[model samples]
Target: MPPAKKETRPSSRAGRLRAPAFVKNHRGVKNWKEAGAWLEWRGIEDIECITPDQAGIARGKMMPSKKFTSNTSLALPSAVFMTTISGGYPEDGNGFSYPEDDGDLKLMPDLGTLSEVPWETDPTAQVICDLVHQDGRSVEFTPRNVLKRVLAAYSERGWRPVVAPEIEFYLVRKNPDPDYPLTPPVGRSGRPIGGGAGYSIAGVNEFDELIDDIYHFSEAQGLEIDTLIHEEGAGQLEINLRHGDPVELADQVFMFKRTIREAALKHETYATFMAKPMQGQPGSAMHIHQSVIDTRTGRNLFTNEDGSESAAFLHFIGGMQKHVPNALVMFAPYVNSYRRLTQAASAPVNTKWGYDNRTTAFRVPRSDPAARRVENRIPSSDANPYLALAASLACGLVGIDKKVKPDQPIGTTANEDEIDLPRGLLEAVDLFENDKDLRAVIGDPFVTTYAAIKRAEFETFMEVISPWEREYLLLNV
Candidate 1:
C-alpha cells in the first residue's frame, strides 16, 4: 500500500497575491496588438507582437475573411507571424515580407498543425501556427518546420521513434538587490533549500505541495509526466516524461520548461536550465532516451534474436560516436554548458559509449532484446530538444548508410583512454563548423544558424567582466 499522503496548500507568496492583469482578458485577437503596444510603451525592443486576428491566421485556427485594424508594432520574427494572423499572408505559403503591409486581407485559421504550451494559464488553449508567405510560399527556415521535416523522414520509412527526456535544472533566488552577488537564497529559516540533498526521496517529499502543483500543471497541459525525482545536486531536480514519438517528445520538453518557470514564480523561486547555475555544485543535464519501432509490424528495431541489440542498433551507435564531436554545439549550446561535461559525477566528457555506464557519453540500458535503445547522456539542460533530436537521428542514419561498426567499449575511468572534448562554446562551434560530414547531414542552414547563435552568445559572455576578475585584478592593480 502507498504511504499516507500529506496535507498540501497553495503558495501564499507575493506572486500569487498579486493578480496578473492579462489573466481574464477575453478580447478576440485584438488583445495581442494591445499587448504588443503595452510592451512597446515599456521600451521592449522586440516590437513584434501579434494581434489576435494575426495569431488566428498563424495557428490556422479561425481566420475571418475580413481585415482588422490595429497600428501595433512587433519584433521582426514575431511580426512575420503577425502578418499571417492578419490574413495579409497565407498560413503555409512562403516568401519573406516585412515593412510592407498590404491593406485589408482576410485571416484564416488552419487546424492541420498546432503546438500547446503547458505553462499557459489556459491549459486548453493552443499555440497554433504554420509558416506562410504573402505570395503563398511556406517559409522553410522556421525552426518548427525543421523538426517536422526530420520527424517526417522517420515516419515515411514506417519507423516510429519513441523518445523521453530527463530535464534537470536548478532553483535559484531572484536577487535584485545591488548589495549582494547573485546566489541561491535562504528560506525564512535562514537555511538555504538549495544546499545538499543528493537523490533523497524524503528531501523531495519535503516540498510535496510544490511538486504536486507541478504535476497538476503538467497534466492540465497534456504533458505525460512519469515522475519527478531529486537529483544528485543541491537545489537540483529531474522531471522525467513518458516516452513517445520524437516530435511529441520534443514538444513535451519545450512545454515542460515553461511549466517549471510559471510554477516557480508562484512559489517565489527562480528555476533555470542554465546548465551550471552555481559553482562547485553539480550542474543540470538533459539526458535523452530513444528507441525506434516499425509502424506496420509494431516491432522494436533495436531488438535481436537473443533479445540484444541488432546490427542496426550497433550501426546507430557508430553514427552517434562519429558525429557526436561535431554535433557537440547542438548538445551543449551555451558558454555555461561546457561546465557540466566533466569526467565522472555522471557527466560524459568524452566521445565514448558503454552499457549502463553513466560515465560514457552514451549508455545502452541493460534491457531485454525487445526493448533495446540508446540513452544519450551528453546533452546538458541547455540543449534545444528539436535540434538535438534531429542531429542525433541524422548521425544514426549516416551510420546505417555507411554500415559503420562501433569499436569495443571504453570501460571505466581506469581503463578509459584519454579523450578530448570542447572546453568552451567557441571550441564546440569551431568543431561543428569544420566537420564536413556533419554539415552535410544536418544541412548548411542549420549549421550556419546554430553557429551564428552560439557565436553571438559567446561574444555576450566575453563582454561581461566577471566577479572573479574584479576580486583578483582590482586588488592587485
Candidate 2:
C-alpha cells in the first residue's frame, strides 16, 4: 500500500487545528479546534507554555518537563507538562506499596478519551494524567513533554521538524509457555525457533496473522505505521512509523511502542524493546530520519534554493556534532544500549554525517534541493522518545543559534579529527556529568538525577551474576 500523506496542523489562517486523518477517525471529533480545546480542558497543557523554565533550571536536566507532581500534597504548583496514568498505585510514593497503591487519586487524564465524559467505569481508562509534584510543579522526568518543549523552539523559528523512527524489537519465546505448561523451552515461533535462516521475510509470514493484528491495532490507536518486516533474529521484527513534526512524531513513537507490546500480549507472545535481547542475533535499533519545514510558508528549511550550502542545514549538523557526547545518555540510556553500537551492521560507533552513508552516525540522503534532510543513526529502540528528540533539537538549535559550522562531511566512518560516542553507559554517565553545554541546555537537577538513576542501575547490574560468568569461570576455577 502507498504511504499516507504527511499531516500538518491547520494553516494559521484557518484559525483551527488541522485534524489528521488518523485523529479524525476517532468517532465524532468534527472540528479540530474542538479537539485541541478538549485536550486543554482535560489538563493537557502545551509543553512550551507549561514547562517551567524555573523548574527546569532548578532540576538541572534536559527535558525536565516530563516530571509529575506529588499526589499527597496539593499545595504545590499544579501546572506540569507530562501526564501520569495512575494504575491502582502512584509511582514513587509511600502508598505505592500494598494498600496505599490502590487509592482513588489520579494525577492527570488522557485527552484522547475526553469525548467519554465521567470516565469512571471505563476499563480501558488508564487514569493517565500529567506528571506533577506535591509542590504542584510539573514532573521533569516525563519523556513526552520533553520533546514537546523542544519542538516548540523550532515552531517559533517558523520551521517544523519531520521525524520518523524505525523501531526494532524481539518477540521472544516465552520461557514457560502459558498454554503448554509441561513443555519447557517450546515456543511457537509461527514456524520454528532457531530455524537457521536470518532476515527471512517469508519465514515471518507464518506469523502474519498476529503481526497483521498488531498493524490493525496500531491503526485503531491512531498510530501511523508505514511498514513491518521480519528482522535478522529468530523472533525479531521491526515496525516503522511515518514521520511528522518532532513533538507529534515522538508521541506517536511512544504510543507505537505501547501498542506493539499490548497487542503482542493478546497473542500470548512476549515483546521486548531491549537493544540486545539475545546473543549471536541482530539487536533492535531505532533509526531516526528527520527534515525541517517552514511553519509560515510551509517550505522545507533543509532544502537549498540554488543548490548551495544551506545555513540551516550546516548549523543543524553542527548542533548534532556539538552535543553528540552529552546526548549519549538520552540516545543510549541503558547499559544494554551500548551493546548495539557496533562498527558494522549499519550501527554507528563514531560521530559523523555522510551523504547517503549508512555507516555514518548521521546520514544526509543525497536528494534534490527540494527534499534535503539528515538522519540521526545513534538512538536505540528503547530510548525515551521525549528525551531523544528533545536533546537532538536542543543541540541542533544551539548550533544554529551559535552559527556553528561543521567540516567536510565524513562519509561512512570517522577520521582522526572526529570524536567517538561514549562506548559504555559508565563512560556516557561521566560525559553527561561534566558536559557544560548539555547542562546549560537541559539543566543541572535533571542531569544529577539522571546520572544518579543510571549509576544506581549500573550498580544493581554489577551485583548480579550472569550465565556468561558461570560459563567461563565455573569450569576454569
Question: Which candidate achieves the best lDDT against the true structure?
Answer: 1
TM-score, one value per model: 0.74, 0.72
lDDT of 2 by residue, 1-477 (tens): 111222344546443434344344431233334444333323332221111221121111111112211112112232221111111111232111222232222243334422221112221212123445545554544554456556666777777778787888877656554333211112445235553435677756756766777777665445677877776666777777887767556656665666677666767777878777666666678888777887776777876667665798899898888787777888887778888776565467777888887777788887777678788888887777767777777777778878878767865345333337787888898887777766666755456655655665676667767777888999998
Model 1 compared with the native: what TM-score? 0.74
What is the model-wide C-alpha lDDT for candidate 2?
Answer: 0.59
List lDDT for all candidates, in order.
0.62, 0.59
Candidate 1 residue spans exceeding 4 A from truth = 1-124, 132-138, 177-182, 185-190, 194-196, 414-419, 475-477
Clashes of 1: 26
- Model 1: lDDT equals 0.62
